[model samples]
Target: METITFHSYRGGVGKTVLSVNTAVQLALLGKKVCLVDFDLRAPSHQSLFISSTFSMSPTAKSFTGFLVGDHEPQSVINSTDKENFYCVFSDIEIFQQKESKVRTKLTQHGEGRILAKLFEFVRYCNTQKFDFLIFDCMPGVTYRSLDALIVSDKIMVVTRPVKSEISGLRLVISECYSKLEGAEIFSIMNQVENIKDLVHPPNPLDVNFAKVNVLGITKCLEESSVPIPLLHSFPRVPFVTERIYVLDEKNHPFTVEIETFCNKLLQK
Candidate 1:
């Protein structure tokens, strides 16, 4: 089974959106896929799945619990309504308990043991004959995020077309991504400017500025210390809130973009 991790230098870049929809899309294609919410710092998959047209088996065994040896690997996996699609969610409550043993195990020490638990989960998935194991990781370079990166076969670096992200992305690449030896690194340039989506009469200045933003981000990736190949670019799709568009609105531009991205990812 191929393991892929969706990571970002910063939050609010739609990493979870891409990872969640991609997993569902793959399941729709008749693949046995499991998506793990490794973003324990601020877990959202539980809520996202709860709100979507999908249902996760009610379980108290969270990924964090499994990592801390409070639960077994098999127990943490919550089956979903979608066939061949399963998910392991992280418990934010556990993380929020500043003095909680689970939180201490994850944050203070036992780095090696925590990584082993992650590997154990992957092995369990492999034994279950899963086609893909995707991790919706927390943004930035934390020990947990790095463990996910180290265990992944491919790292999907999600970035946005913003000037502020340019320098931050560079630092992440230099300090974190560059040191990773085995995993193949690729980037997804998300929230890109698409003139076609502009208003009835687009302003000239707005159009020019959009072009510059896209160009700046492109150059940032190409010129980074370790150039990360651009896998796909997703146009900014305005949404009031997060939902699984692939299931709720299959024809949505965002869902269509996700489908196209999944197709390209399968090729790799």
Candidate 2:
């Protein structure tokens, strides 16, 4: 199984939105894909799918339970309403509580236990025969976040056009390179208005510092590039607020392009 993790140095950079959409698109193409909500502190992937009607289930159990020895990792694998996509929801509240308790325990014991639990979870996912395992990681460099990076085969750093976002991307890339030797790292620019319009076009400056593999650009369908590119871009679309019937893949621009991207990835 190939594990792809989406991460960012800071929040409010549309990591969850991109990760969920990417997973949905891949699933629509009939690939067995699992979207793991590893963002324990601020869990929102489940919210994106069910919105206000979020409920805990056998598959949607909290990661905290696994971390604290309350439950096995398999207990947290919850199937989403979507056909081919499943989610492992994070229990943000429980994570925060346990994080506070960490101080009481020996530092290495607390940290090591969490790392071991996460690796065990990854080994379980490998056994499940998933074609693609997408991890929506938490923002910033936390022990939990680093654990995700260590386990992943490929790391895709998502960022916006803002200067602060770029700076954060640099830090994230640097940290990932330092720990994950010889891991494939790619950069994707999300929510891009116009590639040419930006005052300073993003070049390969500090990218080499982290030894990043540059993926092609993704723009809106109207503004999309000719011959397409490796990176899949989408126009700013209306948020799917409430539960609605899934649209046909051909009809939805975002879904169609994303599905195409997944096919291309498989070919590679």
Candidate 3:
């Protein structure tokens, strides 16, 4: 099975939204896809899945449980109503509790063990004949994020067109992504200014501002230490909150973009 990780230098770049939609879109295409929420610090997948129309079976264990040797890989995997779609949610409470042993297992001097557990989960997915295993990883360069990067076959670095993000992306590339080996790296320029599709006040000044920002982000990616090809660009859909758009509104602009991205990703 091919393992893909969706990561970002910072939060609020729509990484989780893209990863969840991509996993479901692949499942809709009859591919067995398993998504794991590896964002332990601020887990969001559990709430997204619970609120969505998607159907998920009761999970006996979370990803944190598996990492801490409290559960087996299969037990942590929760099947969804959509055939070929499965998920492993992260427990946020474990990360929030200061004295939580699960948090200690992930944060302390157990990175090697954590990585081994991640690989063990991957082996289980392979044995299950899954077509793809997707990881919605934590943002930035943490030990846990490194584990996700090392175990991935392809890394999707999600970034946005903002000054802060540009500088942070450069730091992540120089310090983390450039050091990684044996994985195909790609960038997803998300929330890009879609001037052609702008449907708001239609201010010329706003348009010009957006153009400059997009160029800045593009240039930052182009000048990275390691060569990371541009995989896809997702336009900013106004007023569309993060949801399972692909399943909720297949014809929506955001859904269309996601479908297009997934189709392109399958080719790689």
TM-score against truth, every candidate? 0.95, 0.74, 0.95
Model 1: what TM-score? 0.95
- How accurate locally is residue 118 in candidate 3, as Cα lDDT from 0 to 100? 92
Model 2, span 196-220: residue lDDT tens: 4345755656444322322222222
Compute the lDDT of residue 52 as modeled in candidate 1: 71
Residue 167 local lDDT, model 3: 86
Candidate 2: where is the Cα deviation over 4 Å?
Answer: 52-59, 81-83, 95-99, 102-111, 194-250
Residue 45 in candidate 3, Cα distance off native in Å = 1.4
User: Across residues 1-268, which tens digit of lDDT does each residue of candidate 1 receive?
Assistant: 9999999999999899899999999999999999999889899988888877786655758888889888888898888778888998988998888987668789754748888988999999999999999999999988888889989999999999888888889888987899998899999998887777666878888788777777887888888777589999998887725788888898898988989999999898
By lDDT, the best candidate is 3
User: Tens-digit lDDT track for model 3 on 105-188?
Assistant: 888757499999999999999999999999999999899998999999999999888767878988889888999999999999
Better of 1 and 2 by TM-score: 1
Least well predicted 10-residue stretch by lDDT in candidate 3: 193-202
